[model samples]
Target: MTTSTPAGHARVAADAPHGPAGGRTALVFSGQGNQWLGMGRDLMAREPSVRAVLETADDVLLGATGWSLLGELAASEGESQLADPAVLQPTLVALQIALAGLLAERGLVADHFVGHSLGEIAAAAAAGALDLPEALHLARLRGELMRKAVGTGRTALLGVDAERAEALIAVYGGGADVAAWNAPEATLVAGDAGTVEAVVAELTGREVFARTLPGDIAFHSRFLEPLRTEFTEAARGLLVPRPTSGRVVSTVTGTLLEGGTDSDYWAANLREPVRFVQAVDTLLELGCRTFVEIGPHPTLGPSLTDCCAHRGVTPLVLPTLRRGEGEQENVLRTLWELRRTGAVRAAAPAGGHRVRFLTAVTAETPPPALRGRQAQFAARAAAKALTALGAAVPGDGAATATVTWDSTDDLAPEAASVVAAPVAPGADTAAVYARTPGTDWLRLATARPGTGTVPTLPDPAELTARCTARRYVADTAVASAAQDADDVLVRLRPGTGTGRRAHLELAVRITAAVLGAHAPIELCDVTGYDDTVAGDRVHVARMADGTARTTVLDAAGRPLLHIARSAWRTRHTAADPVTAPAPAAAGTTEAAALDLDALRAADPATRLTLLTDWVREAAAAMLRTGVDRVPALKPLNRLGVDSVIGLELRRRVAAVFGAEISVVRLLRGATPADLAADLDDWLTDTPDAGPGTAPVCSAPGAVGPGPDLDDPADIERLLDDLDALSPEEVDSLLGRLADDAASEI
Candidate 1:
């Protein structure tokens, strides 16, 4: 297989046998170093099969480790967890197994299975020789044991042939061993720190490129001996490899494992070098023409490609999913390519096949109105459509344009057209449909096709209301109402009663639907008679000005409620919440209130304690509980502190600390403890935080309202910032401005 466009189908050789989904393909699982953040997340969301597999593995790993596997995958942290043997090993296996299961569900089956290092477990599971739960448990134990083993470093040597690579290791390896034969020109070595360094230094002296791999675990070397005994004993109970339809070529032995891979075999697999080249060659010898990496990302693709290249033959190589690319798109693209290649032919499950029918359905009538010709044309078109739909045409009652399907073996067309005989507007076809219960459906357009363009109205968020009741109702109902160009109609649900409040809310909802906004509404002027109840259709006509007049009508067409000039002022200025007055000079009382230098000059530990207390207090305020109720170590979110509350807490923290804190950090930190730790570290490290140092604001986008408010430049700058405020923020700014103006008056 060759690389295709981002959205292009996977490409296979024209002559290859159709692989599984109908093409011949082999599944290869990558070892560690292939996992990354956001891996499999998109796929899990898009594909039900993939989600099922991942969710199942999540439960299994969570049960074994008391941590969520999916959570780790989605976390924003870097490769720290991936470096942990206990975490990375199980996660890699889980990702690979899930990808394999996803493909199988889409009708793709692997002809051969191959895995590198820890990936062997995933491959074994894919071949049906090992149970998933058993594999997960074994992977976790293996990782944990290996982590406990004594080792320090691992490195890969490049630009050296296989012979020279082995010779260099034998000569200067010190205590390190060749861990993996990744490619003919690339070899991985692992051992204690000094030995690994010695090998790298010697290789550099010899002019052969060498670099240390990520993480310090000396996998596949003598360092893992400590794990072998424990791993073997544990595997004896869980590693029960049974017969499988697909073959699993062993990288440890450089050949196929006969009968089945036993517990002892898995134990040794941890300490042996991965002979990936030989395994690839063995798979080719077994007639495998396509190689697909079944993991989060493709780390083995280059190595396997080199292996095939060395054999002087080209093989189809693909990855199940790659970083940055959507998982479902990649799978679908590959499947499309595989179908094109004929390695596998697409086939649907029994009774799941579907056929769809569509018609262009032109509408036209001339003065002549040749009824006979029209009928003949309609019949001919219907027949052609039925043939295209793979549906049987009616013989005796052909005048009805009928299609038929057998209920047992054959099912109805997945898509069927619902057509109605043309009728005048407002024609009551309801009675006719009531009589014939099986009628599919029909739609009637009241206006003629060539009618004048419909007038339009501003969305509900645009206009302001004059009546308070109307405004309140409008704001609440705007989200649920149905509005067209010139009119708005809202169907009150069954629960709203004929009480005074309900009637007022309905009037507001109707008025808001017509005028758009709820604020600045003047509702006290209007008086109501009877209340409106549920099932009433509230209609509002959009007036030329921004305001609207509303009427609530009962089912019988009698007016239930009315409002005169219910909508608000036509040209109201929206509030600007974010705008703030220019800051007074440096010594202003507001600026002096939050003096952080004294706090910073205090002992670091005392400062940290105080800061922690502040966080607790802020969290309590956000949760609307007493400070004693806040959990200092738990994440604030777990205590029902929402975003609004979190923002308020952030504001409080900024005011008290007189330091700018990152909103991102505030949101992403694992818990209050994490936030407190970060703040403490920052305070301790910041040199300017000491006494006698001039204070500076560090909060993002908060350089504002400084002590030089009278300066023209400061005033201009403040206004510029205000211009960037969102509509909600602007509204808040306007409210603050109104309060300040009232104080002055």
Candidate 2:
């Protein structure tokens, strides 16, 4: 399908089928040169159908080749026999067949099937022309015969059309022949090794790009003629053909297979060039507009697209898997695309588990008036919604209910409407929305069946130790706190009364601190407050939708309260003002005491400890937190320090320690301990420099020196210099100025 953008929104043209009832769909089986190590392993582990097919193939091949198909696929690169033709060919066929079975299970049934080169055997078996065993036997025999063929041929792909490739072969006067036409500008040629090498060298001289395929076997070339007789004889003994249940397009003859194949047909398939483009044209003529390539990787997609494009059609082409990517994710993406394009129908299970959508309340049916505060009203509203939707209410005890609010606007204790619907087809969960009477409905909450019992709580000490190891600052308000990645767990301060609103506000603040967010919190979901327990632990997990889910658990691990979803409103207020230190006088004992020379003269261990302590104290001052709470090894950003604050900290370091450090370095995920170590290293390597000896000027709006202190511009400069002077320096200067004034008097 073609993708276009109109009005800044992507639009995919569904020119093919709208659903299974619409246009026909075809399954395109891929051939060789696409296999990789660890291919199809994910599928084998996740899909029972795939695993069954692979295990069956392994059993089948063991008796025939005395080697395990599963073992070969699991082998590391160096130990793998996947490069062997005898192993790779059958392995590819088995994988393709397994993928087809998987698609069929997922409600995507093929109306027709096609294969390129060795893939034809799998296509035939899938179309019911041959039994699986017969097809697998043919694959084994074919691989064995091809591997035993006596030939010294090689193959290479060229960035040229089939016609130019033929011309080059003719001009070179070699025995090379075109093996396959891949795309409008891509072609494959095969010949004896020396001739193919010379042809590639000649193309390189012309600045034409060409790449030689790995291995020495020239498939779909005349080099396999020696095995033709033996393959035909072996196939004749195993031949037992029947009418296919589905259509099978042939790449050998480039048309639909009219009848069952014979030994001679199999022999011709072995020694003939792959007419992939022509077969694609036949599929297009037969009204198939959606093609799903079944293989470990997409080796035929480019060719299929090129062929379809030549006919002025942009057919929907999808691959079952790709190399160097997660196979399960790729397969799911393909399935999702197919369903989105209406090529497959999402099927529900046999039983009627689907929840019905609740109709919106009409003007005639006025809602009940709300009573009490938001928290109390919300609980009653949720119970009413569950009853209206014919759902069972969560029982008291360890049961919990999740409530999500779409808007943070305070709901008045007046008339309000509650509408509910199922989250998805065949889902047990229901989403409920609440709004003022006579207004549009927006989702406000969702409730699912709760667990009958409580879940075990994680060890608080273990979590605390992990937090300390990661150098995360703990919230003092929280009795004990810990963090793992984006998840934060904090115990409520003991003796705090169990107030729902108060607990929610505390949880939101903790989440905001860890996220480094300054915006107001929007409540998305809250759960389990029917039996509010004092001293509950709040656990907040960051969600993929930029929201956090906060759950409050009691000491016994039962969920006492839960906020299913909460998010920042994206509008930020001005930060709290930072308290600046009083100006220190320059050239005084106090200023000299803060110099780096003293730190440098100390032993390495003591120096590191001193610097680390200094860093912690400075960071704490900047963050407006307790010095004990500042983590020595935690990243500055994780400790809620941003760029502006980092710059201020950098200036403070220069002023206090007489060292200049960049703001970028302070904010690049470096911890207080790391910065201390770096400073220690710098002090050790650098000699005593007097450039940073002067204390920084701290007067507000102060500038540098000017021509005269009497001038308005120079007055600010004089004030700045005075601010930089030590207490003793200031006293001495004041005495001298007083004496001069007395003499003038």
Candidate 3:
């Protein structure tokens, strides 16, 4: 099949079967060199009809065959299978055919078909060009014979002039040919490895590398002409079918060849250069818009896109080879997106075969991360969208899927009793081709065409206040309230009022760009609230015990916050506690006035690091700095000689220890978190700890005033809070909250 564009159009369409989502005349299949191990193995297991075809593959190849090519290469670092064309051609074919079968099994049919040289045979089989047996037979003979022509194998060069590569090959190495000029400045050359290496060494200003491959001969280059004649004779024995009634491009010239007998297909392919570049141009001429690479690898995709870029035409390349577990699901999903955007006719799942799915979506078109011509907006969009759907699908065959979102203000939750909440059950397979959900934060825009009742503010805050992952309640309530005001319902767990901080608040920014409004404001804090008890939204608590009253006392008069979130909590226990010791006093009053730096400087290398760190920490204490970025300090109770470390530091201080001038004392004239500023200018400092020590775990992004109480009084208050944590009810609650987070993941 060919791609099409207006006579004077600036961009060309790579040949794809589905053409554009809206077109009728195209056939899509991946090219050679794209196989991975185990690509079609699943299909074979699931569909005996498919397995029948792979069985023939076993008979067609020798050592390291196509069966080993598809996905096995991906197992470890530095392992690849881009070498053998014989294995590559068929291995790629296996997966594409499997995908095609899966698609066809569900009635997603195709029309005209064509493939780059090695892919040509697979395409022919797909388009009735050859039977499975005949295709495999032809491919096997072609691979083995090509292997005989060039002993060490070949490589494809991209972003370089095919002509230049050929010249260098002829001048510096054994005879070689520019086998396939896939695109302008993109070429594939094949010959003896040593010879190809020599030519490559002479070239500069281009990216050139060997693709993973089996040690086989060059199939498309002139070096294989001898085998070509021989293979041509052998191919004559098989009754090659007539080229499909519709036009089919010949890799030899990268253009359509008309009215050729069946044998001519084999003859032309044998003697001609793989004209991938010309084929891409022809497709562009044919008015095709998008190209979907069927299987194995998206071999020609990079080239075709580059080809278009050369003449200023940029198009997308969809490789079926990269699809995950659900092949048909991914293909169908891509088709739907194409249809939604007006590329193809809407091919919705009829029914009964749909998989229920829920997904997190963003309304931001081409979200900030996916920008530019260098990338395929449509392809990336399709990949992202489909993958999300896949994520929300349950492994237990649950027809329902749910999606969560960063913003849920507009999302409305079901009432205490609402039947028939819609579950995600889309047949879109884009998910199969999407990046693993964990690898990237792919956000989708959740804009249903018509709206019933999205979500509102007060309700969301009430819901968020239910989960206390965030330690700020009023903050959570306010943010949740804002979402209510803005009509956004976030996709997350329901709230539970249990937390680490007395109050936990999880807040993020939500801006409305699509509905077009004035400047966007930040929705500060969102708290998880529980509804199990007196119907109150407990905004800032880690969890609510199942046994405890679900009704919260806090939200008696407050509106429910409907933040579209899922709720979970778990249990945790405090480790045994350890006590700290006081710093040692200096020997003499004069010596006690020495600075900490001088004291540390006198220590051996090993002792210096710890003592110096303590001094800086003391400075931070003076500045009242709190909470560390990295979780470096082990819990005091976990250390074997916890007090010893502290004692050693104090002794180091006492050695050249400065005077016991409270950092808080100096801070009366200075600022916080920077003792250097309020650095004692009077008597040298000593390690009794300069004063005003900050508390640990002071929540992220907190900017607040220090305690009004004095040192001993503040310490007493802290100890009291720690003691309060032991209250049976409080312990039970924290236990449940911790449990919730663990349960969710």
Candidate 4:
């Protein structure tokens, strides 16, 4: 497939090998403007592997930009300002790259890869075309440079074809440029803010439903040309030559990246229109039967579908994460679709009139973090479901029962329950698709444990309740995986329990069963708690090993679950269990307990020498450098003392000398020697005496001896005393103190 804009950038030929031998899957990445505050939180909790990605990203960004990516994600509301080009560009790249690693852990391979806008950087990194650090550095540089371009912005016009969009720009753009050819009916325009707004007004007047995007600068437009030279120079050190691995369909040029990724290619990519429609078709021509959108949400799923339709192809489009879906469940469901379609085969067979039961051991205790958290109740619910799975007898009549995990139970529930219910052995069954009815969902509910009360278990008949049959959540390529034939689809109600709103934490544990494989699993697409209770049936289908691609649903029959799949294992081994780190403690040395009176009696020079030696020792110990090796006149950052370690230095000084200092002051002091001199002077002229010494006092309105204001605690106390006075009193005191100091000078 080939397409070109008026600029005649390039052409794409379907020359790459279609899908790999097993099955072809293309990993598609979403760019900026798709981040939300709670995006990958649940996934991080459920899968330590995903948590590692989040940690790495946080560390890298924190080191490079002095901003906490994780803190921003955790602190912001749903409508976070991650859209700032500076924040979003780097964040989006990190998110997509991390998600790609997570997906790879689930046995989902990308035969062909493509990215939209900044997403291309992540794709290159995922495909071995670029290293992660290099990609991250470039992304950070791109975002920072783009953020510098102010007064311009981007706007999108819906229901407008590319031709109509271009014509509208010519008519009302007033110097605006078409930024992207997003879809058959969606186009983005960028330029000066006023011009873009004017275009939006003109389009809205014509009932085109236009809106501005969340950015302050015009991207993919000529407005950014002024920054090209500087950006190219900075990007040169950040990007390496692309490798010869996974093929990446370039949305910038609408062709394959033949020479691999490079500084020049990325430089041009920054100002090029995203020919997304053409790029999708190009991947289709390359024989990628399955398309997976990897990111925080499903912004590109619809566009991918439309692109396939435009080309008269029926490609399987999947999303790794959704706005409000269970991340682990959705991923597992995708794997199920692949297995059902024979795109993937199961590791075991079932035919000997024997049903191999799969379940998590509920007898073990849940982790402390899970205790009393929202996911706690979910653990019990999964335990109940596992009990049912273990009790199932082949060819037995329908087993109808409700399993309730009363909050009063002292036993903590397991994180997840992976229970498999295969077809009845020796029963007549055909290779036919049976959509689970909605009314067939099981009803589970929770009650808070009463204070100091032990509750008796409810009767099985009284506890279990079945709802009227209903429709199963319609599959979206299993939502994340494509549907298949010759697959055994069964419904397991392990996830039907309900609890307090916070129990959505249970989403991670409930999804853990599907991720219980020898290889680590990565979770994507986690759901947030809404008021509505999810009463939909949980669908399960074995993909490979003991792994089952499962989906839990809301009352509305929407997929509420998604999980990644790893090689299934019948036995369990916690090779990597999540645990909290030990807390740090401050210790006092004999030097710290030395008498203040001794220091006060010493001469100024002697005191200064002692304080300088102590300061040097503290700095050396904290920085792991020799006392002499530590620079006395250089900034702490020069010795790699980041903010985290700077604070530690402050603590060390306080512990050793009973002298409190602020991290800000310690870091900003001219040098260690200068700071020590100030501290020594304060100690020698102690205002308030220790138990064995007399107080050193001057006249009532006199200046305190030598620069003693370096003590943060003393400064704080001074500020507090000043605050207690009336405004007039404060002014009068300040005037008197200033006059006394001036007279002394």
- Model 3 agreement with the true structure over 261-378: per-residue lDDT tens digits: 3655676676566777666666666665566666744566677677656655545445553433333223434433333234333232445442111011111111211111101112
How high is each candidate's TM-score?
0.45, 0.47, 0.42, 0.48
The candidate with the higher lDDT, 1 or 4, is: 1
- Estimate, for each residue in 1-745, the C-alpha lDDT of model 2 and write its tens digit: 0111112112122364322334668899888778899998877854666888999999998998899989987899889988677888888888888887777655565779998888988998878787767778888888888777546588999888778888777777757887876666777889877767777888888999888887787777778777788889988868687886439988887778888887787787788877777677777766777888988888887788777777666577888888966575466556645654555444422353221101111111111111012333354455444433343323344344344444544444235676677777867677767777667766765656554344343455555555542222223234555667656677665544355444544555555534434333344334444345664676766665567666666676555555555555321112221121222344444235466777788888778888888788678655644354687888888887875566567556656655544444454587888778766766776656434653322222323322322344544454579756543334333434444555963
The prediction achieving the highest TM-score against the true structure is 4
Q: Where is model 4 more than 4 Å wrong at Cα?
A: 1-23, 76-83, 244-246, 343-376, 380-745
lDDT of 1: 0.55
What's the CA RMSD of model 3 in angstroms? 24.8
**Candidate 1 global TM-score:** 0.45
Cα deviation of 443, candidate 1, in Å: 35
Ranking by lDDT: 2, 1, 4, 3
What are the per-residue Cα lDDT tens digits for candidate 4 across 487-565? 2222333334453221222333333332322212222112222324543333344443444333344544444333222
Model 2 clash tally, residue pairs: 8
Write one digit per residue (lDDT tens) for candidate 1, span 1-745: 1111112112233444322223356789888777777787777654555667778988999987987788877777653476677888888888788888766655565678889988989998988888889888878988888767644556555556556655666676457777777876777777767767776787788887888766667878777776677777887867565885548888887667677777778888887777777777677666667788888777887787776666555566777787765566566445534543455433443466311000100111110111112222222222232233222222211111121111111101212232332134453211101111344432211111111122232233232221123211112122234544545665554444464345544565445324434222222122233443343556676556555556555544444544444324211122211111122454444225444566567777666666676577557544434354576777666776654455555455555544444343344443565666656665666745532332332223334433434455744555579656433333234334444555964
Query: What is candidate 2's CA lDDT for residue 428?
Result: 67
Q: RMSD in angstroms, all models? A: 26.6, 25.0, 24.8, 27.1
